[model samples]
Target: MQSLVIPLLPELPGLVHASASGTVWAITATLLASAVATPVAGRLGDMYGKRRMLLASLGLLVVGSAVAGLSTTLIPLVVGRTLQGLSAGVIPLGISIMRDELPPERLGSATATMSSSLGVGGAVGLPTAALIADHASWHLLFWISAGLGVLATALVLRLVPESQARTGGRVDLVGAAGLSTVLVCLLLAISQGADWGWASGRTLGLSVVGVAVLVAWGRWELRARQPLVDLRTSARRQVLVTNLASVMFGVATMPVRLVQPQVLQLPTATGYGLGKSLLVTGLVLTPTGLVMMAVSPLSARISAARGPKTTLMAGAVVIAAGYGLGVGLMSAIWQLMMVTTVIGAGIGLAYGAMPALIMAAVPISETGAANSLNSLMRTVGAAIASAVGGAVLAGITITVAGATVPGQNGLRVAMVIGGAAALLALAITTFVPRRRPPASADA
Candidate 1:
């Protein structure tokens, strides 16, 4: 769902009969909705039932996709995209459900696979959406998403068991509202700062208000009887460091998504550009998702034998190496593919380790909210990366046949930043406390 509309972005204004600026809301709406909804959905999942919330989320996806598929105007499309974003909590909820349903021996691999699905969907969605947009009416993109949503909903209803674990409590409406406001204010600013101007009052105002609300929200969460998020638990060494590293990993993983396509598709007249079609670009990047899936079992095994901390550190190192190689590898499609695949493997490893670390630190009852918070951290990191990468690319540009585009140096700088972020994650991961056996278990 994340990558579904990306390939079609250039044509969105015409398709929706709206200005480019207005149509941008379609993407922004999704980001805002996902940011606000993910944590709330997780909390609700823990309170109600993971399967029930998962079903509800999938239902939204189905309805949202259908709405988007049928839409011809901007408002309805934005609404549909927002609804699709509301389903972002499904991943963490799925991981939590696995904790409840799967045996300890199988849990690591199961969660790893579930976690890696995030990348897989994005990696695969690009080519699929690009192919659909090229050959068929673009509405088919949403229709197909709707169909897949329906199929997934049915399968989950029929096959997945409801989790027995529950954190029975009233919804913390105040906390939810506070967090939502903070996220909207901050994410909106970050996402739009480039268009709006970083120094613009709107951007600075939102950033200030977000931080202020966050401080108040933290205090409220610390006091609330049935808090939306357990700040105390989140403050634990393992969970805290894991989430911090998750943010850096989020930052680390985005450059490939942001820079590689442009590098691939920009006109070869620019000398450094590969000048590939969207279809070819998507195919070249597809190996990243494949490699991520392929690495899940290895990640899980490393986590099992050593610790999630070790796996996370190893993943960070691998990601840094990938980006370092990417700095000089942009001239050839094969080189870019190899770089992305390596980064994907690292992301798969890190992503899989995150849930394990969070679940291990928090009570099973808190898994949904905890995992969701971790997921939110990653989203925040990605937003930061997007903002930073956009600024860099926009700042350093070269005109190719009268059209301004990011220069090769800008792309290389972005890759370098990504590598730095990965190393920062590695440094953060070093602080994650090593796992110890349960007191009741024998050494």
Candidate 2:
């Protein structure tokens, strides 16, 4: 939705013309809400019912999408987007269900395949939305999304089974509040920092508030019985390492997010960027989804044969190695394709193993919260990368044609940072000792 700002900005009439600050606020709210809400909903579903929660999530998305489709003003659009954000938890919730319901032998690979759906979702959404906005009414885009939501709601009713782990507990409202507050403040600071000077009161105030809230949240979790996030479980050597790696790996993964456009938009004179039209850009990048689709199951095989931990580490190393090579080779179109395929393959392998690691380290009952926290960390990492990546890109300027054009320097810097981040992920994956999970009570 936020990405729509560039193209949609020219289309909307008489709107206060959203500033970057406002846009950040909207995206921040949606991203943070989605990250926290998904796990909270997942845990709730585990205790009450996933089917009910899934339907509710889909409904919220429909309402949000419809509202966004009809929205003439920005506030209403933001409201709709926030509501839509609730759907982010669907994948994690779905993955957690496999753990609670599936047999051990079938669970690992199922978990891997389920997690890869994130990549698939993003890759699909970008192109679909791009095509609609480029060639058709943007309104049609949201309407179609709403229609899909309705269909998904119907499917969930017919297909998803209710979980039996219904346990009575007061909803962890206090814990939820604490965690949301921490995330909101920290992300606000990061998202708003560029517009507000880093040292200005807006940035400083949010940063201070964010830190204090997070610190307080930590202290509160230590004493809370049914914590929103189980910090202790999260701190386990295996869980802790995997999630720490996720944060860095997630951040590092954004180079493609940055580079894809550069590759497609760079002038043909440079002999790299296709210089294709907007629709063409989407079409060119379409191969990424197909490659990821193929890599995911293959990654699962590697995970199964080599152990999830080893698969994850090898994937991270391979990702960093690709970026390092890309620096020298990305000048050619085929080189760009090769680099993207390699990176996508690595992501498939790493993303597939992350959930397995988190599930292995925590109590089965806490999978919803744990996976959500991991999801939260992944977004936080990505958010931080986005903030810093923008700064890096802005600082480096390249000369092209008669005008001073931005060279690939920003991308190179970002990729190097990504490579370093991959190394960090490699370090984090090692502490998961590869010990076998104990036989289940059901097993």
TM-score of each: 0.98, 0.92
Highest-scoring model, lDDT: 1
Lowest lDDT 10-residue stretch of candidate 1: 434-443
Candidate 2 regions off by >4 Å? Answer: 1-26, 268-274, 399-405, 438-443
- What local lDDT score does residue 247 receive in model 1, on the 0 to 100 scale? 92
Tens digits of per-residue lDDT for model 2, 87-129: 7777777877788788877887788778877776665666676
RMSD after CA superposition, every candidate: 1.9, 2.6
For all candidates in order, the CA lDDT equals 0.92, 0.74
Per-residue error for 343 in candidate 1, Å, reads: 0.8
